[model samples]
Target: MAVQGIVTAADRIRELDEINGGLADMLNHMGQAIKALGPNAQAGSDDLDARKEVFQEHSRAAYVCTQAFHARMKRQVYALEEAGIILAQAHIHSATSSAKHKQANNQPVQGQGGAPPVPPASEAEHITNGGLGNLDVGWLNSRGNKVGMEKEAELLQEAKILLEDELERRRGPAASAG
Candidate 1:
């Protein structure tokens, strides 16, 4: 059981790493797209030039905000990955300790005994109880965490809403032109 927990945590960490990589790639693409727009105005008239300036300012601001957001998200993802590592280590340590304790008494490694050794508090619990930093790995895996299902659902809903809003904004100009 403890081994299974460790495996599961390892798998989750891999998944999160993949997700973080994809997000970083997306941020890089966004930055490249913004840069490709060029800073100099290509408008022919004074009024158009002024409008282009305003548009450039807004685009720069948005790009900066997005970069900041991406940086923060990356940090959070790294922290979560670190937490998973810690949890997996703890599981392995616990299992090893249990085996050693049983061996000293000449007991079977996996058989009815005086009860199994207590495992360390889960990674989610460690974070929640303030043993570690303030991160919600429970949302990633609620196996042993005290997190409510609703919280995870709410997070997914929020992400969906943000994506939908971005899609709508992107389509607005095209729809108006048509």
Candidate 2:
């Protein structure tokens, strides 16, 4: 959903760019006409008025597109927030389950020898220690809970790239100049 929202926002941004280009062309043509005809010239004034009306239409369209882009961005943000919440919940569930498993294993069962309970290693420790690569994710696959996580990661990466491209485009030549 976030990826789709980014795409929708990007499309709206492109529409705004095209509309702005048309508006700029109209302004340039109007300026050239006025300069060529002088302020008092009435020839083709009706055409100029029609062009002004078209420019206004383009401006209104651009405004609507801008609003749409803003809405899509908000939706993307909401989607991301929801995804974060879900991931956090999953993490907490995993931690709780791991703790329970460790506790159960540490208990002395009937007929078991009275040896000291060995401290069980935890997946959460690996996660907290920043060892995501070492973190056990097979449990997720077995439970069918994170089957689409890889695809989600890819979509998020694409969204990030799209956003970066849009930001760079908005920055324009000034970013390169600096």
- lDDT tens digits, residues 54-89, model 2? 556655565555666566565544544454422222
Clashes within 3 Å, all models in order:
0, 0
List, residue by residue over 1-178, the lDDT tens digit for candidate 1.
Answer: 2374354555656756865665666566555545445544344444655655555665565566567667766655565656653332222335577677668877666645656554334533443323334445664575654466677988999999999999999999999999
lDDT of prediction 1: 0.58
Mark the regions of model 1 whose C-alpha exceeds 4 Å error after superposition: 1-46, 85-178
Best by lDDT: 1
Error of 1 at 53 (Å): 0.8
Least accurate 10 contiguous residues by lDDT in model 1: 84-93
Candidate 2 structure, TM-score to reference: 0.25
